[model samples]
Structures are given as C-alpha cells and as structure tokens.
Target chain A: MAADRNAGTEPVVDMQNVSIRYGTDPEVLSDIRLSLEKGSFHFLTGKSGAGKTSLLSMMYLALKPSSGTVTVFGTNIGFASRDAMALMRRRIGVVFQDFRLLEHLSAYDNVAVPLKVRGMKESEIEKRVRELLRWVELESSMNKICSTLSGGEKQRVAIARAVINRPEILLADEPTGNVDDDIAQKLMKLFVEMNRLGTTVVIATHSQELINQYNYPRIHLENKSLKVFPALRRLSNAE
Target chain B: MQNKIKLNHVSELPLKKDQANLFLEAVTAVMVFLFSIALAGYMLVDSMAKNWQNGISGTLTVQIMPLPGDTDSQEKSLRLNKVITFFENQPAVESVILISETQKERLMSPWLGQDVDISALPLPELLDVHLKQGADFDYEKAAQALKEIAPFASIDNHNVWLHRLLDLASSIQTLALSVLWMVLAVGVFSIFYAVCTSLGIHGQIIEILHIMGAKDDYIARQYARRGFLIGLISGAIGTAAALSAFWWLHHSAVYLSAGLLGSLDISSGGWLLLLSLPLWAALLSTATSYWAVRRTLRKIM
Candidate 1:
C-alpha cells in the first residue's frame, strides 16, 4: 500500500542524461533519459548491444552512471552509500534472463530469500512465500530444487521471488528469452497481473514479436539514446 | 504434504557444503596441531628449568683431595673431619654429611671395578652440604671457608652446568614459541584464502542476494559463520589430538627411560592456554572471512 501513490503522480524511476561504461572502454549508454510512472507496464526494447541491460542496471542501482544522475523513489543514488543503495534495491525486484535462481536451494527457499534478507519472521515468511508460489502456479513444485525445474518453471519461480515482497517496481531483463513461446506467454501474463495490482513493470527484450504482442508504452534504446513510444503506438506497433 | 520439505533460512548462504570447506578445515586442524605441540614443548621445558633451578640452587658439594704423591690416609681423615666441623659450625649450613669409605667405593666402582683394591688409589674425601630453605648463603664465602680448612679442598655450587641447562631450555622454549607464531600466521592466511575462494565460487548466488536488497554484512555473515564453525570444530579436534599425543609420548618416555622426564606434564596455566586454541582460531577465521567478504563485495558494488 505504500506504493499505491496515484498512477502517473510521480515516476518510480528517473534517469537523467545518464552515461555508463566499464573502465576505459567507450560508454555503453550515453545521454540516456527515462522515466516510468507508478502502476504502469513498459517494455525496454533494443538490439543485442543497445544498452538495455545497462539502463536496467542503472534503474536497479547495480551500476552507477558515469556523468549523470539516477533517481529512484525521488532520491539520487549516484552517490548513495552502499547501505543506502542496498535498502533502495529492496523496493525493486529483478528477474534476469538467465533465471539466476540459486541452484542449491529448493523453490520455496528461493522465493523466501527477499523476505529472509529483511529479517522477516519464519512463520510469516513461510506463509507469504507459499502464497506467492501458489500465485505463480508453482505450489506443486515448491520443494523441487531450482536447477531441476523446467525452463518455464524456473522463470515462474524467478518471477515469484521478484514480486514476493510486493516490490514497488519489477525489472526483468529478457525473462522469456530462454523459454518456449507457450511458456513466454504465460510469463508475460504474470507480469501483466503484477502490473495490474499496482507494481510498475519493466521488461527489457530485443524480441520484436514480444514487443508487438502487447499494447503498452515502450522505451526503446538506439544509438545510446532512449525514445519513448506512448500507449497510442501500441496499436500501430502491433498492426 | 510437500510442506514438510526442508527450507534453509537463506538460499545463497555460502558456497554450500563442498570439499573446499572440508579441505580448509583440515589445513586449520594441522595448524592447530603444530601450535599445540610447540606450546606443549615450551611449557614442559619451562617447568623443567624451574625445577632444576629449585633443586641445584640451594645445594653445595665440597671435596678434599690430598697431594697426588703423598701417602697420608691419617692426614686426609683429620682434614676431612676438620672441614665437616667447619661447615657444621656455620649458621647457613643445614647439614653436612661426611663421605664414608663404603659410599666412596659405591660411587667409584663403576670406573674402578668391584675387585680393584680400594686402598691402592688415593681418593678424595667428599662432603654434601644442604643449605636451609630461604637461606641467603654466600656461595663464594662457603668455597673460601672450605679452602682454608684444607688447602686441597674446594667447593662446587653446580653453577656452570646449571647455567648451561637453563640456557638450552630457554633457547628451545623460544624456538617453540617462534614456530607457534609461524603456525598462527599460516592459519590466518589460509583461512583468508579459503573464504575468498568460496566467495568467488558462489559469486552468482551472492550477486542475486545482493540484488535482492541483501546488505554486505548479511552476505559476509554466511561465509563468516561457516569459517568460524569449521575453524572451531577443527581446532578443537586438533587440540584434543595434540593433548593425547603428548600424554602418550610422555608416558612412553617415562617407560623407556625408567621414569625420566616425569616432570614433563604441562602446568595448569599451560593447560588453560592450550584449551583456548579453538576459541582463538575461530575468532581469527571469523574476522578474516568478514574482511574478505566486505572487500570482495566492495569491488563489485
């Protein structure tokens, strides 16, 4: 309920003229500006090396921008302390394309991680984790080791883990890149369901078919610049 | 029904159970074993040195040998009795026992043989003098007093051999302490290396946890706790092994040498120090892992 501030009231993520690079190499992202309103669903579409992951990294506070400010929840994290940044990251849940689930832990434990890190009580954590797993239709495989799950099942588990804390924002970097079309569609529905319940969702993908399949605003990355396609283009882009 | 499945508190806790931790624990155990040996050696030598000082520090021996060519048993007897009376008169002297001919033969039989004529060789008259406990007797004065009683008589306080034994004991103890220090250094470095390796192997799991809003301390604690637990268990085993070894070795030595080195048992303080090894090792391992985790995490974020 803390994030139930009116949709379009204040942006959840605001990146202002951000530029990022690793070491002495060329900037991966340059002069990139992006903003997403609360309770909105948006797709970050770009080619393989068009800096989509880099932009999402900035949004999650995993990478600092080189020469510009990145504000999350109305706070600039360009110079945030390590503790402050970690606290900020809890509000954002990320699902990597690789489904970075801990292979050693069972599905139930994998989803309980975000809550455990916050020192949640075990009873409360168990109830909440079971509930979230049930939402993803993974309650049957709750005890299965993450590595043993199918690609579709793993993606679902990742989603459940991301949204378990009811994060104000959810960022997925190509969540369906490794799954079949049937499974991808199901995963997309999970994201849409989360968005409908007031969680801002950002999915970065280069799959044009996925982009065209949905009617939502999109932020496209090209030549180090980010361009926004509002909801009207959803029909045009789909057609 | 599947709700009965075991769920860990944290998913990315560590590099999980692996041979890496087991190997590191073995290394730590070896270090603790070596340290315990060195400490036991140091304690045993120190205790022996103290005992030696106590025994020889308050005793003196006086000998009266006649001129080599002179055949004078009557003169020797008179001078020996005079020397005994001179010592018995001194307030510092607790008791002085004059050497009887039978005792002299018993001491000389090893070198001279049992059948040799005892009267054929000129042997010195000996006196054993014990000083009173807490007596501040002057050693040089006692020697001077004995020399005046008979020109051929001289006193030995056993200072030369005592000094040599004490010096050797101290050197051995110092070397043992140096070895203990080296073991500690190796223990710390090895623990640090093990923790860093675990962190590297579990890097992805750590990154996932980090992205999920896990603090650096929370991430570090996983490895730190494991490191501490391994070190503690191994250290305790190593300490126990060392103690048993020392006990067996001391008893074997006593058996082989016919009860020699019986004083090799570690004193109470030394036992306390040895028992503290596990705690010290655990603390060191925990601290090393904590720093390693913090440093590794900092490099990424």
Candidate 2:
C-alpha cells in the first residue's frame, strides 16, 4: 500500500457551517460543523430523510454545500475544478444505499470499475478484483450479471468495489443492510481492517445493534442538525 | 477458475444495442447516402465542366455558306480556299483543317435523314481552326476578317454557347455541394441529439460512475467510441449505396447521347475522395458525440 500523500495534521474531512438544500426546497442540513481525523472510524445514524446521504455526498465530493465550505482531504471542495474533484474522488470510496452497480456487467466487472477508471492494467485489475471478490465470498458468482444477483450479493459487490482501490476515505451507506449477521460482521471486519491500514472509515447505517457492537463514535442526525456521541464502551471504561 | 477474462465485454456504461442508437445509425446511414450521392454528383459535374472547357477553349469554327443561286462548284471552292488561306496566315492560328466530306455528312446525318445526299443541299463548308495555346487572339477581329473574305462566311467562337453550358454545370455543382454540406450538418445534429438522449437515458449510471471517480472524459469516451462505430458502419453503407447508384448511372449513361453527356467518368482522385467520405463521417460523429457528452456532463456534479 502506498502512503496517502494527503496524510498530515489536517483532518481528512472538515466541514464548517455547512448547509445543503435541493432546488427551491428548505435546507436538508444546516449550519453543520464537523471534522474527522485521519484513520478514524465513525457511524452516521439518522432517521429516514435526515440527510445522511447528503452529508456522505458532500464528503465524497458529490454535492457541494448550499452554504459554507466542505474541505475533503485538506482541499476546499467548493473551489475544486471538475477534474480536480474527480481526482479527489478517486481517493474517496463510496457505497450507495441502493448498491449503484452497473447491472448489465458481471460482478467481477463491477468490482473492477474503480481500478479500470484509474487506468490500471487489466491483468492487475483481474488479480486484485478476483482476490477482493473471493474475500467477499463472491468468487463463485463473479461472472454473474449484477442485476441477477440477490440484494445481499449486490451489497457485497458494492463493498468490494468501494474497497478495491484501498481508498483514503471510505464512506459506506448501509453497507451491510442486506447481509445476514455473519456476513455483516465479516463486512465490518473488512472495514475495520481497512481502517487499521490507515483508511478513514465512515459507515452510515440505522442498525443500532451493529453500532453497539462496534467501538466507534456516532454522529447522530435529527431535525437537520447533528450530535456526536462517544463510544459507549469507551465512555464506560473511562468512567 | 477461468484464468482469463475478456474485458472487452465489460463496459462501465451499459450502452450496447440501445434502440435509440439503432435509430441514430439508421438516420446516419441515410444522411451519408445522400451526402455521398451529392458529393459524387458535384464531382461529376466539375469534371465535365473542366473537360468541356479544355476541349472548347482556344478553338474556332468557320463555316462558308454557298453563294445565292450560284450552282458553280468552282465558285464555292474558291470561297472556301480564300477563308482557309485567311486563317492559315494568322500568327495565332496553329492549323486549319477542312472538314472531310465524310465527317460533314456524318455530322449532318444526325439532323437530316441518313441516306440523304448532303452534296445536293446548300450545306456550308466547315473548317476547324485550332489556335496556339496561350495565343492572344481577338475573336471580333477574326470574325470581322473572315466576313470580309466571304460575305456569307461566319466564325463561331463557341464561347457563347459554351459559357451558357458551363454556367449551368457550375450551378449544378454548387447545388450538389450545398446539398452535401446540408447532409453533413444534419448528420452532426443527429449524432448530437442521439448522444444527448443517451446521456439522459443513462443519467443515473453516469452519476454513479462520477461518484465512483470517473471523469467527464471517461464517460465521454464511451459515447465517442459508440458514435465512431455508428458513423463508420453507417457511412460505409451509405457510400456503398451511392457507389451502386453511380454504377447504374454510368451504365445507363453509355446509351445516352455520348456527345452531349461526355464520358460520365470520375477521375482516380475523385474516386479516392469519394471513398474517403465514410472516414470523414466517422470523425465528424466522434467529435460531435464527444463534445455533446462533455457539454452535457458539465452541468452534472
């Protein structure tokens, strides 16, 4: 693994007085200030339509803040050119809740997209993609079209794609939502392993059970505002 | 486990066998066909105009008519010799040849009956006057000189009728070229519309690719490739159709009046240009699609 050129004292993601709104609609999120240090793990928890996806979108450089600044990897995203934004996005991996995979392509091809987008040679892409798919227990279904795959299979494929690049910042939206407990734990372990390797991990989920099992801070969204809760086990241990 | 994967089967954007693209290909084929035909027509007319100009310019025709009620052949022969001698003495005249009786009879047979005795009629004596290339000859002065030698003699410079024919050919060439340009414009617009529609159709997939760190060029390249293939295949079809039409026209032209229509033959260089239309079409389509995709993607995240 190569060292992240952006690794430094600056937080991996820094949001200041950020607000987001759709066209002609009220703000989905407002006046948010947050920062995540490098190599940190956090769970984003919110009710339906609480703008969890929007926050992830901003961090992933998909959506610009309606007001204020969103600085990802130490660069203010509002000022980034489209090409620059694309480069920044390459360092950040995202798993959408809907599992945005190219349905017409095979699972192998879906996992290979990030590497292919980076212009990696096909041989290296094949080795990396196959290894990741095997780790996700999708080797048997590697050649199956994504549209024909079950929801849990699609979820695993999406996770494989997100982690294939070993992104500097990994944002997973309900990554384990469709998987069973065993696979969900496996997926969580994968994220934990990535974090241990210096990848910042952010998981957006409604699964409080999974949250309770993991020793990470929680950013809870309610009424378009956010509150941070320290890890319960860590708080108890401190007490 | 299969050790080899055919990566060509994989596309980040699923754009294969799209119905909209099929329609676009059909439209492109039709446009290319029209463009090829118009281009070939323009080339043909241009070639004909050049040939006619080369054959007609710098030459004059002199016709000595029979004297009124003069049945004496000696008198007519004297007048003919006088006009021929006058042209032969001019410095600009390269050579003057009296039209053969057989050739005159053949020329008149087209208008008169084939068996009619041309000698019995008061047919004018014709002479072909060839002038030296680049010679500065005054047509009015030459005609005036010829009239003085024989009162009934007239010099046909062939410029007035030739100019009218050349003008008509030039207008047709311009019209054909204009049609070709219009076809190309329509081709570009059709490709643009197809690419824009594809972008809209694949909007979600495009956003997903973007979120996955794909650049505008990355996605635009896929469309460009598709556009290029469509243009190439469609252009080939259209060019083939146009070539067939030209073949039929060439075949049919052989039976028509050869003197008026000329050879109807396109030169080797003209053929090469005609054959290159498909490549130009492909390039045009590629540029149009690439531009359309990039322009549309600029509005996206």
Candidate 3:
C-alpha cells in the first residue's frame, strides 16, 4: 500500500494490485502495487524469502502474478504473446547472485551470447565482447573457462554480459554478495555507470551498507508488500 | 586435457560432458548399422532374383524317361538321339546338350555321397536346351512332338515356376525395405530422447538464454545442429562397419549359399549408395531434433 506514485514520468515497469500464490498455498505477495520510472535507479531491500527475487522475476517477464497484471514498457506481461514477451526481454538486462555462466564457455563467449542471440555478425560480436571484457578488467580471463574463474571475476563477467546490449532496463539480485569490499565496490561502480547511461536499474539485496553508502531511492519489501523511501543522502535533481 | 573445439556463431556446441551423451551416439550407430544392412540386403536379393529370372526365361529342360515296357539300353539311346535330332533341326533352339551320366551323378552326389554309384538305378536323361534371343517358339507344339516320339517325355519350361521365385524375391525385398524404414523411425525417436535429456540437464542455462531474449527457433536450431553432427559421425562409423560385414559375408560361401542372396558382388554404384547414408542420417536427426525441441520449448518457456 505504501508503493510510490508514477512521478509523472513514462513508467518502464508498472505492477497493479498483483498477488501471487502457488496452488492452495498462502499468497507470497498480496496486492502489491509499484511503478518504476524510465531512466531511474532504485534499490529493493528485504529479508530472506520476502519475495525480492519473485518480484524481480515478474519484472523480467519470467513469471505472471496469480491475480493482477504486470506490464513492461506498456505491454501487459501476463497477456502478451510469447514472441512479444521475448522482444520485451531483449531490452532488459539481468545479473544474478550465482552468476549463471555456462561452464564450457570462456568468459568472452559467455558475454557474447546475447549478441549472438540477436543474430549479430561474428566479427561485430567478437569486437564488442572484447571491448566490454577489457572494460571489466576481464580481458586477461577472456579465454579462460567460466568455471575456473574466481567469484569476483565471474560476477564482473556477468555484469559485462548484462550491459553489452545497452539494455533499457537492468535488474541485479544480490550483485555484491560473496565478494570482499573492494570487489563489491567495483561491481557497484559498474552498475552505477550503467544507470547513469540512461538504463532504468533495479538492485535487490540485503546489504545495509550499500543503502547507507549510496543516495539511490529504496523500495523496501516486508510482509508481502512494498514501501518506497527517498535516499537519506543528497536527493537527485531528477527526483 | 581439453580438445580444441571449433565453433561457429549460430551453434551452441557446448563442449562439456553434460551437453552430449555417448550413449546416444552408440545407439545411433547401431540403428544406422541395422538400416545399412537391411538396404544392402534388399539390393542383393533384388539383383539375384533378376539374374535368375533372365537365365530361366531363356532356357528349357527336356526330361526324357524310359518306358517300362521297353526298358533296354538300345531303346533309351534311340529315344534320346531322336529327341536331340529333333531339337537340332528346330530353328528356335540355339543349342541342346544331353547331360552326361557322370554329370548327373555329380549333381546327385550331395544327397548320395561321393563314392555311391547310380548305374543300376534308373535315372532320367535331361536335355539342357538354350533358346535364341527373341525366338518365338510355341512351347505347346514342342510338347506335343516330344509326346509323339515318347509318351513318357515332358518339357519343363522354367518360365512357368520362375514367376514364383520372382514373387518370393519381391516379398523379401519389400520386407527388408520395411525394416529399414522402421529402423530409421527408431533412430529418430532415439535422437529425440537424447536431445531432450540434454535439455533437461541444462535447464538453468536455458532459463538464462530466455532472459537473454533468445527465441524458440534460435534455441531449437542449436539442438538441430548438434543432432546433425552427432548423427553424421555416428552414421559414418556404422556404415563402415556394415560395408565391412557385407565384404566379409560376400567372400564366405556358407552364408551366401542359402536364401535369396545367392552369390552377391556389390557393384561400385551400390557401394556409393551405401556411403551416402550418413547424409540421410544427418538430415533425419536434424528434423527429429527440430520437432522434439520445439515441443519441449513450448512446454518449458
């Protein structure tokens, strides 16, 4: 009930009266209403099993809510055709906590997957992937198998892969977990840069330090509902 | 150590143990082996039947048996000589040769043993007659003339019973071809299962691809390519094994002596046909994977 208003901007993500349940179980998320403005940065913070990942899943069009509708870029996620949903997903970038990289692929190959999916020319994909990996300091590990990489290195590779296509929306779930302070800071910097470049970014995490360290607005999920709060630091002119 | 794997842009040749199973490859090889053998057998049987048909239609067997009332050697020779003269005088008969007693005994040796003498036993004489190509000889008139010379003589026009041999060969050929079709179906189903298993193991990666905005066609094409390559390699190995078997069996008189596959020497053209099966196998596997993966992705995504 405490979700934010649309803020008079074109909404990139809009969820209205959404409630979800599996079979006869209790509703995990009940009557949640939220809208994400285009070109805005927001953080999602919640306790374990408070439906942080579930909300992100719905935003990416992977799951449909049981009762209500969720729309991405004005297309109803629950009602759109599969092909239409696929096109919508192409404009969104996702980074995961586990860094789901194919073990057989090298770092460069993993990042090139999206471009290859789009049917880009081999030379173009190769050049872009190389440039992105070089930016993430993974140029040395480009040819290394993903499974052999350290936790920090794998997450950086995941970040590079997510932003390769300059997606209009970006979602990261626990992007900074399982890494030291320096590595976490580096990953945060990458996300911050992606947001400044006009991508609507959403990050879901349990880290209070990140919330205290950054001035981004926060959406707190508790008891199957969401409440939005302005950041404690300097308020943005855009806000 | 990791082998160098060449990759193209559109294919997801996941060079990992989880993506491909050797069991699938082995099953494919066995199916292709069965298919190759069945096809080769059909060709061999069809060829033998044709040869026998040609030879039988162009020849006659005049069998002369002695009458019981006058069973003397003089009477037997008189009847045989007259029949030989009559056939020689006919314009349609190409050549006629009386099968000698020694040759008769040799023909019967398989049943009578090598040293057994059939001199005392009454045996009919056979006149092996060859007809000229395109000759229009009235076989009924020839039978009537032989009957007048000796009531016990009969003409065995091999063309009469040769139809039955052809029928048997045709039936066997049809059966072998049916078996080949069935084996191909089974091969396709096997590949379907293999591709499905690979997808099951890599569900997480598939979810990631879905997140990456890969369409259903793109994902399915990757599996199709994988299936095609696996089928080509496995089918080549299977065909090589089957051709080797054909060579070994062709040289062995014991196996080839029985049944419709008598004395087969595969032509170069036939060998070429056998070598091209890997391409067919690759295509079949590609189609099967395409259908199977589309179905699975529908259920998955």
Candidate 4:
C-alpha cells in the first residue's frame, strides 16, 4: 500500500502549487501549498466565499485540484483511481456546514452509516454506534428521524457519524454554526478528545470567539491565497 | 429497534416511492408482456409447423373422378377397389381407406354449406393412402401405373401444399422472433433510462455515500437488488397476463375451428420455458441496473 510505504515519514495531507476553479469561472483558490502532520489540530479561518470549503474538499478527496497535486495518505489525488480514492477517503471524516445527515434516516442509522459503508458486523456497529451516541448525549433521540431533530441534534449525529470509524483525519466546516455556546464547547471538546487520540482535526468556522477560545494554529484563506498562523497560546497536553 | 437497524442495513440509499421507479415498473411490465406474447407465438407456430409436417409427409391422397356418361355406380366402386388393391400390393403402402360419404360431407361442409346434399352433387371418390414411416415410394411410377389401371384417377403428393404452409409458418416465426428481439432492446433501453433518472434523483445521497467511502459496488448492489425485485414482480404480472391471453385465444381458436386448431398445443418443455421468462427478465434487469450504476458513478468525483 502506498500509505504503508510512506508511513510515519509523510504528512497526512500534502498539497503543493494547488489551484482550483469551476469551469471558466475565475479560480476560487490559487497557488496554495499546505501540509498537515498526523495528530495535529488546526482551525481553517476565512471570510465567506474565500474558498475554505474548496480547500477542505481537496483534502477529503471530494474535488481534484484544477492544477498541481494533492497527495493524501501518500497517494497523489491526481493519479489515484476511483477505488483508491474511496479507500483513502475511508481514513478521513468530514462534517459539512449543513450537517448533511441523511434526513430520511433515524439518528442511529445516520450515525451508523460510516460503519455500515465499511461493511462492519452489525453487532460491532451497534455497540460502537450506541456508545458514541450516548457519549454525545443523543442516546434518547437516536431513533428519531434526523429531519425531526433540532439543528444541534443533527450536528451531533453528523459528528457521531464522522468519528464512528475513528478516521485518521477529521475535517469540519462550520460544525458549531447552529449550536448554543455550551453545545459548541462540548463539540470542541469532542474534536479535542479525538485529536488527543492521534486523529488530525481541521475546523472551518466564521466565529472569532470559537477561534479565540482554542489555542490551535489556523489556516486562514484570503484573497484566493492561504496564510498559516501559529498557535497563539501555550499548548496543553489534551490539545 | 434491532429490526429497524437490520432494515436500514438493507438499503443505504433512500430510493423508494420515487415516481420514476413507478414509471419504470409499469414500462417493464408492458415490455415483458409484449415479449412473452411474441415468444409464445414463436413457440406455438414452431410446434404447429412440426406437427403438420410430420402428419402430412407420410400420407398421399388419391382421387377418382366419376366415369363420363356412365350411370353405373358399380363401375366407380370397382375402379376405387382396383386403386386400393394396387396400393395394398405396393411395398411402401401401409393402408388405404376409402373415404365414406359422411366423411366427405364433413370435409366439404367448410367450403360448401352444410345444408347442401352431397349425394345430389357428383362428388369424386377419395382414397387416403397411408405409407410406411420411412417409405421412399416412387410417386411418378405409382402415378403412371394408376393412370394405366384407371385413367380417371390421380395421386396427390401433399408436399407442394405442405411446403407452402411451412414457408408461411416459418415467416411468421421469424417475424415473431424479430418482435421479441425488438421488445428486449426496448426493455433494456427503458431500464437504462429509468436507472439514470433514479441516479439523478438520488444524486445527493450518492455523493454523500461516496464521501463516506462507499464503494461503487456497494451502491450498485442496492440498485441491482431493487431492479431485480421490480423486474421479478413486473415480469410475473406480465407473463401471467400473457398466459391468460394465450389460454383465452387457444380456447377461442379451438371453439371457432371445431377442434381443428387443437394441434397447436405447446409441449411440457415449451410451457416450462415460458414459465421461466420472469426469472430471465429479473436477471436481465439486475445486470442492467448494476452496469448502469457503475458506469454513471465513474463520472462522479
């Protein structure tokens, strides 16, 4: 496996001279270079329409760069086959800004999707999914359809699904956008707990307060370019 | 709760109750119905032709006209007896039966009204000569000998008319088979269109699945299963409808022809083949759906 071939020596994600655009439209992101080491956590900060989602999409193997290379888990996204990209995606989890839960499904089923897609045994899936849903304090609402759930509840389900597989990298876009401050802090703690367990995390958000509350480095998108800001506070062991 | 989980595992895509799927099922049923009828027609014609060829090939008809200006009934009887004796003496002739007046009347009733008195009309004497199964009789020599013995007698080989009938039957079978092929092509195209439409309708779920690391085969299997079920159900309905129509037609034909069309019966094996059409339809549907899904997914990110 290419992943095994470059294990421990390569960054989890490495992008060099990457540019992306849709059709004849002007490039949304231009000449970007970024690398994310394993077990690291960072915040992606940018104004609206600044291509933050576009960059995260490149990392998650959802979009190929218009030019240059995006190498994820040691496989270049440009050269990887569709099956290979799927396997690569297995090691990454994503939380879209809209939650993107399968609304027709129950919260339990939505959270169980990642494991089901992986073809895990039902018993194993049930155990893991129930445990995670309980941790997110959604055990009671697990059987309710996601369409009926409040925004915060749906966000939790989405988070439960993303982390169900214990993916090596977790990317969130405005994950806390629809939650109260207390729920947002709890969600942050969940991401931090995942990071403490050696999972790399990247969060995209417009909340300056959330960014201020956490002391992680930031990948800020500006004027179709990228600039990385180092941690502003001393690091804690959990972070 | 456990049952719900198991059910959820059965299908990750929420593809049920789409108007497109209902349209597909209706279209599939109609196509299968047409195909089944065409196939049955082909099989029936093929069997009928075989029966006719077998029955007609081993027999010859000899007709003796009444002697001109001779009112002697004994002379007609004597000439028919001489021809019957001559056929009996031939190595290949099995049995020759003189046609009874009643039998001749029955044969003529279709052309001439039943009310007509056949005795009033001077009908020719007809003899049915059955030959040995593998007989290679010299038809020309027999005809020449009959002319010498009774100048008014002539032999009917039956092959000329039989060949014409077979040609007509063969043409019908070919037309039926062509219709069957056209129906199949239309069925495949309809299924392709339906699957593509479903894919478009469920595009968001599919993208979410792909982002969740679902393999193409994973999603394709669900669609295949759905296709198989729809095909099986619609195929059953179609084949059943066709079988009912065939039963009605067979009965109506037998009634109208007064048992003449009873020879068009399908053999047991043919019936079994007809019964298996639904399974074939289901398999075709499953394969088409799987292929269509895989091909479409390849174009996605």
Question: Best-fitting candidate, measured by DockQ?
Answer: 1
lDDT comparison, 1 vs 2, better candidate? 2
Which segments of candidate 4 are over 4 A away from where they belong? A1-9, A233-239, B1-10, B68-70, B89-92, B111-117, B138-141, B256-262
- Model no. 4, DockQ: 0.54
Rank order by DockQ, top first?
1, 2, 4, 3
Which stretch of 10 consecutive residues in model 4 chain A shows the poorest summed lDDT? A1-10
TM-score, per-candidate, Cα-based: 0.87, 0.94, 0.85, 0.93
Better of 1 and 3 by TM-score: 1
Full-model lDDT for every candidate = 0.82, 0.87, 0.82, 0.87
Q: What's the lDDT for residue B235 in model 2? A: 89
The TM-score obtained for chain B by all candidates, in the order given, is: 0.80, 0.92, 0.80, 0.91
Candidate 2: tens digits of C-alpha lDDT, residues A2-81: 12322346598999999999998999999999988888788999999999999998999889999989888879998889
In each prediction, how many residue pairs overlap at the backbone (N, C-alpha, C within less than 3 A)?
Answer: 0, 0, 0, 0
The window of 10 residues in a row where model 3 chain A has the poorest summed lDDT is A1-10
Question: What digit string (tens of lDDT, one per residue) describes model 3 on residues A106-142?
Answer: 8888898888888899888887888888777888778
Candidate 3: residue B56 Cα off by (Å): 0.9
Report fnat in order of the candidates.
Answer: 0.77, 0.55, 0.54, 0.61
If both were scored by DockQ, which would come out higher, candidate 2 or candidate 4?
A: 2
- Per-residue C-alpha lDDT of model 1 across residues A71-127, encoded as one tens digit per residue: 898889866788888898899999988888988789999999999889899989988
Can you write out model 3's per-residue Cα lDDT over B92-189, one digit (the tens) per residue? 99999889889888778767878888887777889999999989989999999878977778889988778888898899999998998899788877
Flag regions of model 2 displaced more than 4 Å.
A1-9, A234-239, B1-9, B68-70, B109-117
